[model samples]
Target: MSEMYKKEVPLYGDLIDLVSDVNTETLAQQPEIRQQLEHSGELTRLNMERHGAIRLGTAAELSMMRRLFAVMGMHPVGYYDLAPAGVPVHSTAFRAIETESLNRSPFRVFTSLLRLDLIADEQLRQEARAALDQRQIFTDNVIDLIERFEQQGGLTKDESQQFVKEALETFRWHDNTPVSKTLYQSLLAQHGLIADVVGFKGPHINHLTPRTLDIDTVQARMQGKGIAPKAIIEGPPKRDCPILLRQTSFKALEEAVSFQNAEGGYDTGHHSARFGEIEQRGVALTPKGRALYDKLLNQAREQLGGTPNEHNAAKYYQLLDSAFEAFPDDYQTLHDEGLAYFYYRAVDDGVDMSTAISDLDTSASQTETAKQAIADLIEQGAVRIDPIVYEDFLPVSAAGIFQSNLHDEKQSDYQGPSNQQEFEQALGAAVYDELALYQRLQSQSLELCLLALDSKA
Candidate 1:
């Protein structure tokens, strides 16, 4: 890491201030919300291409990333270990939040720091590890500044100007310094965006996941094309409510590449590691509701015996839907239930809902009114269920994918016991005590996916 990059760049937390500090609440309610989302997505794609390598390497690049992302109101959230599957990988996933939802939940970026040791030569690997060990990734000043800015939200005019300037600089690459090919290779892999980062010169987009209303259909269509996925998109099986998220990735297509060797010569060949990813998402359910949803999925699965496939996805969804058709508690009745998680106020005026119920078309007795309403809302845009982000690669699923793709899965032995508690404490996150949360996320996510399938009985 160079001193110029170090002393000059602002951290991500500070950049978050620059974004959140803007008086943008009014803008969120308008169509601007969608525009902002599109803008943010575009920016992310750009970063994945432009700063693909160094963003994960030196302290400077890491700090710069924080600043750059903060400008878009994105924050770091969960730590996902893609390595549990045993492939050469290191990455974390995040949900980038828009300006409006800051109070509702943390908008996150699933930033990943790839491990260089996996690819470097023995001597280079030792040095890289040692550098990583000694390096201070985040300064106390940076953390303090972020915390203060978060609490205060907006700064004075002068501070805002300075913040914006500093934030932009974080993404700026180091002054075209010539680095060893090996070091550059390590830096490239650090972002974990695409396979080309690992010494290949050919660059391509990894996956551009769309939030679909019909994941089951999409999955079926793709699979029918003989596109075997990296894994079963996770979350729950299709159910009454939309599950949180589902994801699938197609295999990478080969692309031409050239690598510079240790002898300062070029080696040319073709490499492939970039693939298209797609996702479907549903409403973010409450934790308790998520639990019951999980149980319902297990119940549905048990009833179905052993096999699960796309054809039976809707059948299983209907089973869960029938079981939990009504509200769990009485206060919120079917008519009163609007969009599940999203908050909305009636835009139409002079119409008392209860008395004027007959004005709107109602489903017949055989058709459950709530179900019809849900279906209608889904079709008409009142309700929003995102396609599963599929950003998360389950350890088991990742391992499976790696095993399927690799020459061997059993080549390396990991015999050392893991101290999960110590690991959590070190990261300053809460200890994982309950399987309930994980199960619920999975279940609700599945239900959302099921709703997307129109074939539900």
Candidate 2:
């Protein structure tokens, strides 16, 4: 798919080249970071990691998409409602849940369901609904493959390759619109994003993001490399100990589009859809830590009086940095304060870790005494820890990127509360809680470390 996107968007190819160069330099300059990534098995996947995004126009589309992603070992994790942020959609990221699978192929997709309820114009809403109802996003071959995999528990290698070929058709861009030029303009007038979802044959992948080790460097160098970046990077400001995710993207492409006309012909038009994105992921935070992050972010935005944009980007970045100062800036502080998750391991050259543990139960890590015992192990240089890599998306950051790329003006008009139940119903399953997934991985690492140490002792 990366190759497909690169061919479709030449700038994406340049973006990939630029990111690779930046990663090599970053890994070379920061051996400690490289070593930490290697320990957590993130280094191997760093260069290959990519996440793409698509917006669905209906419940049926979203439900089938869940099934489609399942065939690739990706499941929805974390519900994200963007309506409150002004974009009329609720979303979930489809990705592999386990550590081993992520190390093997960290490709994920952020899929969103368009909220027709948020369209205040009832007539336009009904029209959009009718248009969406008439379109089919998946090929018949892909549906058969999905059912085959579900019924048989797996596909043969040949069948799997065929499945991928069929699935890719869903994400491939089509510049031809089913709606008339007038209808497309009406939807566009309501919201550019609404036009995007309602105007397409399928939820074409608008952007694909490659993982980066140093986003700040990439952001700095994008202009030098002839790419105009988004006005501001989204998410938390750069930190010594980064948490969650930071993302920036080059401007979306404006491509020629043809809309159906009144006489069963086509009318020429233009639309901006595809873009290239880059990300730098950090530790997944616990609920408490996320609250702090939310609070600080809200404080900065409220102070700015509006969403950060080109006019306010500099102030916003400074405000974001200053606000996060209250949060810890180092791993030890983050771990001690329960501000971030980490995977623990016995340092092979350090000590006899068996002597540092009185209990081997993985759940014991939650108890006060067990926590103190693990602290002792770390203090004695018997065990070392690495931050658990965050494998999910943030709502605010996601919304910001969407609006920026869609050229959708940010508005606080959509005040509807989050309806995760509705989203899950449309999805045909409940999304996994990302924090629990991270915590489970952390505990599993502790359990394995204990077993390895006891055997050594």
lDDT per residue for candidate 1 within 224-333, as digits (tens), equals 55565543454455543444555454555454545556676655544444444444444444445556656655676578663333456566556655655533432133
Q: Report how far off residue 286 is in candidate 1 (Å).
A: 2.7
The numbered model that scores best in lDDT is 2
RMSD in order of candidates:
13.6, 1.2
lDDT measured at residue 73 in model 2 versus the true structure, 0 to 100: 93
Worst 10 residues of 2 by lDDT: 352-361
lDDT values for all models:
0.40, 0.90
Worst window of 10 by summed lDDT in candidate 1: 46-55
User: How does each model score on TM-score?
Assistant: 0.45, 0.98
**Residue 103 CA error for candidate 1 (Å)?**
15
Off by over 4 Å in 1: 1-60, 85-109, 115-124, 127-205, 223-231, 289-340, 344-457
